[model samples]
Target: MRIYNTRTRAKEDFESRLAGKVGIYACGPTVYNHIHIGNARTFLNFDMIRRYLAFAGYDVTFVQNITDVDDKIISQAKQEYGDELASGAMSPEEATQLVAQKYTDAFERAMSDLRMLPIEPPGAYAPRATEHIDGMIEMIALLIERGYAYEVGGDVYFEVRTFGDYGKLSGRSLDDMRAGERVVVDERKRDPMDFALWKSAKPGEPSWESPWGRGRPGWHIECSVMSAKYLGDSFDIHGGASDLIFPHHENEVAQSEAATGIRPFARIWMHAGLLNVNKEKMAKSLGNFTLLKDVLTQGYDANTIRMLMLGTHYRKPLDFSDSALDEARAKVERFANCFRDAEWAVRTADVSEPSEVSELARACDECETEFRAEMDDDFNTAGALGAIFELVAALNVLLKEKAGALPDADAADVRHAATVIEELAGVLGLKIRSNAKETAAHAGEQGRAALRLPDGSAIAPDEDSMSSLRDSATALGLTVEREEDLVLAVLDKRAEARAARDWAASDAIRDSLREAGLAVEDTPQGQRVTPILSSPRDLAHGSS
Candidate 1:
C-alpha cells in the first residue's frame, strides 16, 4: 500500500519498521469542547486508514492521545466558571476534568453513531497528556542536555535553529517564517522561529511539579511524549488535520528526533484535509462551525456524513453544504436498496440447481477485484464506492431481466458481491446495512401512523405524508411497502437473532408476521415487513 507522507510531500510505499505490523499514533481532541464535524473528519479518515491496513492482513496498533491540558481549557474554565478554586469551589483541575469528560463522551458517541471501527476499541490504549508528564520531563531534560532546548524564566523552549532540518515537514524556511511573523517577539528565545517545549505554570493555573519549577507541557511536547510513551519512540504513521502541518507537527518532529536521535519520528505522516463551510475556515471565532449533533438534527444520517467525508480524497479539501449531504444520503440509499433486494432474492429463490452458478461467481470475483483495486490506489474511496454502485446497478439489472433464470449459483454470486461491497465499505467505517434498514423501518412506521379511519374503515395514506415518510426513511436507509390499509415495519433481525442462536424465535416472528398479512423480507440492510392489506380490526386491536 502507498500512502502520502507529509514529511516528503509524496506518495510513498508503506514500509513498516516491523514486518507485517503497523503502529499508528493519531493526534486526538483537546477535550475543551465537543468536537465539531471538522475535527471528527480527521479521526474518521485515520480510522479508515487503520481499518484498511488491518483488512489487508497487516497487524495494526493504533494509538490516539487525549490532550487533557491546554491553554484553551484553562481559558474556558476561568471564563465560564469564574475561578472555581478562588471562590472556594472546584479546583481548576476538577473543573477542566468535568468539561473534558462531557465533551469526550460526546465525541465517542459521534464516532459510534458514524460507525467508526477502531482497530483497537475506543480508548483501548489511549494515553492522556496529563498522565504522561514524567515522560515529557525526561524528554525535556535530554533536549536541555543536548543544547536543543533552553530555559527562559521558568519556561523551556526548543531552539529551532539547533535542529538542522527544522523546515523539512512544512517546507518553510526559517527566514520566511520570521518574515511573516505577527505574534509579539520574545527576546528570551535564541531564534524567532523557536517554539515552547514547556510553559511555566502561572498563578492559580493547573500545574505539575517539575525540575524547571511548576509547569505544564507545551502543545507539541504533549503529543511527542504521549506517542513515545505509548507507541514507542517511532511509529508507522502519525496523522492529524492539515492545519497541524506547520508548528504543531514540525515541532513534534524536532523534539522527538532530537531527544531520541531517531531519523524520523514517524514512518508515515498522513494529513487529512480540512472541512470548509461556505468558503471559510470552520472555527469558533468564525461562528460558522456546525456541531455533529446539530447536523444529525438536520436529518442527515451519521452514515451519510461519513459518506460525505469519504466522497472526497482524504488529502483534498471538501466543502460542506446541505446539498452535499443530501447527495451522500441519496447515494447511500441507492446502494443499500440494491443490496437489500439482492439479499431478498437470494433467500427466496430455490437453490436446488447449480447450472449458471459459475458465471455469477465470475462476475462476483470481477467486482471484488475492481473494488480492491480502487481502494489500493491511495484509498480512492470515491472511486471504490463508485465501483460498488456499479456492481449494485449490474445486480439490479440482472434481477430485473433474469429473475427467474438466475441459477442457484447466481444467488451465491450475488451474495458474494454484497459481501465484498460491505467489507470494502467497512474499511472506511461506513455501515451500509444500518442505513438500508433504519430508513425502511422509519418510513414504514410513519406510513402506518398516517393511516386514518374513513367511514370507520382503513385506507391508504395521503401522498404528501407518504412522500415525507419515504424521504425521511430513505435518508435513514429504509424501504417502505404500502398495503391496502396497513403498513408493516420490515427489518433484518436475523443477524442479531442468529448471533444469539434464537433461531426458533426468529423464524416464529417471520411466520407470525406473514400470518398477519405481512411479507417478511431479509436483506443485507435488515428485515423488512410489508403489509398486504390494512385491517380495521388489526389497527384497532394493535394486532399487526
Candidate 2:
C-alpha cells in the first residue's frame, strides 16, 4: 500500500514494522468543548484510514488520546465558574475534570452518532492523557537525561538546538523558525525555538507532581508519551489534521525519537487536509464553524455526512455547506436504494437464467478490483466510493430490467452485488445495512428535509399522511433535537386546513415552508415534507 507521508512530503510505500500488524496513533481532541466539524473531519479521516487498514488484512492497533487537561480546559473552567471558583465553591482541579469529562462524553456520543469505528477492545486503544501522567513525566525525565530537554524554575523545556534533527520533520532550519505561538522569548531558554516539555502550574489550573515539582505536561509531550505507551516507541503510522504539521508534530518527532534513541518513531506520518467553509478557515470567530452535534441534531444523516466527506480524497480540502449536504443526500439515497432493490431482486427470483447474469458477476469482481486499487493508492476514498457507485449502477440496471425479480442465477448476482457494496462501504466506515429496513424506506420516501428543534426529534411529515411518510422518514434515520414538535405543529396546522377544505390557508403554510427551503409536496400516497437544504433556523425565520 502507498500512503502520503506528511513528514517526507511524498507518497511512499507502506510496510508494517511487524509482518502483518500495523500500529497507529492519531492525535485526538482536547475536549475543551463539543468537537466542531473541522475536528470531526480530522477524526473521521483517521477512522477511515484505520478501517481501511483493517480491511486490507492487517491487524491494526489504533490509539487516539483524549487530552482532558489543557490550557483551554482551564480557561473554560474559569469562564464557567467565575466568582464561584474564587469563593472556593470548587477547586480548579474539580472544575477542570468536570469540563473534561462532560466534553469527553459529548465527543464519544458524537462519534457514535457519526458511526465512527470504535477502537475495538477499547482499553489500550483509547487513553485519557490525564490517566497517563506518569508516562509523560517518565518521558520528560528521559529527554532531560539525554540533554534534549532541561528544567528551569519548575518548568521543563525541550532544547530544540540539542537535537540536530529537530527540524527534519517540518523542514525548517533552527534559525528560520519563530516560537511566538506556544513558545515565548524566555530569557532562560538557550534558543527561541526551545519548547516547554512540562509547564509550571499556574493559579486556577490543574497540576501534577513531577520531577520538576507541580506542573503539567506540555501539549506536545502527552501525545508522544501516550503513543509510545500503547504502540511502542516505534510504530507504523502517526496521523492528525494537516495544521499540526508544524511545531506540534515536529516537536513530537524530535522528543519521541530523542528520548527513545530510535529512528523514525512513526514510519508513516499521515495528515488529513483541513476543512473549509466558503474557502475561509472554519473558526468559531467566523460564526460558520459548525459542531458535529449541531449538524447531526439538525437532521443530517450520518451516511450523508460521511458520503460528502469520503467523496473527497483525504489530502484535499473539503467545502461544507447546506447545498453540499443536499447533493450528498441524493448519493446516499442511491446507495441505500441499490441495497434495498438488490435484496428485493434476490428474494423474488425468477426460474429462468439470463445471459446478463454472468456480466453482472464480472462487474462485481471489477468493482472490487477498482476499489482496492483506489484505496491502495494513498487511501483514495473518493475514487473508491466511485468504484462502489459504478457497481451499484450496474446492479441498478439489472434490477430495473428484471422488473425487481431476477432469474435464479442472476439472483445470485444480485446478492453478490449487494454484498460487494456493503463490504466495500464498510472499508470506508460508511455503515451500510446499519438499518436495512430504514435504508430502503428512506430511499423510497425521497426524504431530503429534516427538522432541527430544541429537543432531538423529527417532524412528522403531516397529520393526515403522518402514518405513511412519518414512518418512512423515521425509517430513513434523519435526526433532530426537539424539531419534531415544531415540525408537527406547523404541518398539523396545514393538515387541519386541508381537512377543512381551506385551500388558502394550506397554500399559505406550504408557500412559507417552501420559502424556508422545505418542499411540501402531495404525492400519490400522501403529503411529503422535504428539505431543500436550508437550516431549521432558516425555516423558522421564513415561517415567522
Top model by lDDT, which number? 2
Instruction: Evaluate residue 379 in candidate 2 and report its C-alpha lDDT on the 0 to 100 scale.
Output: 93
Model 1 Cα shift for residue 195 (angstroms): 1.2
The lDDT values for all models are: 0.73, 0.78
The number of clashing residue pairs in model 1 is: 17
Question: Pairing residues by index, what is the TM-score of model 1?
Answer: 0.79
- Candidate 1 C-alpha lDDT tens digits along 294-330: 5653446566887899999988888988778778878
Q: Which model scores highest in TM-score? A: 2
For residues 331-414, write the lDDT of model 2, one tens digit per residue: 877888889777766665652433444888889889999999999999999999999999999988988898844568878777
Work out the TM-score per prediction.
Answer: 0.79, 0.80
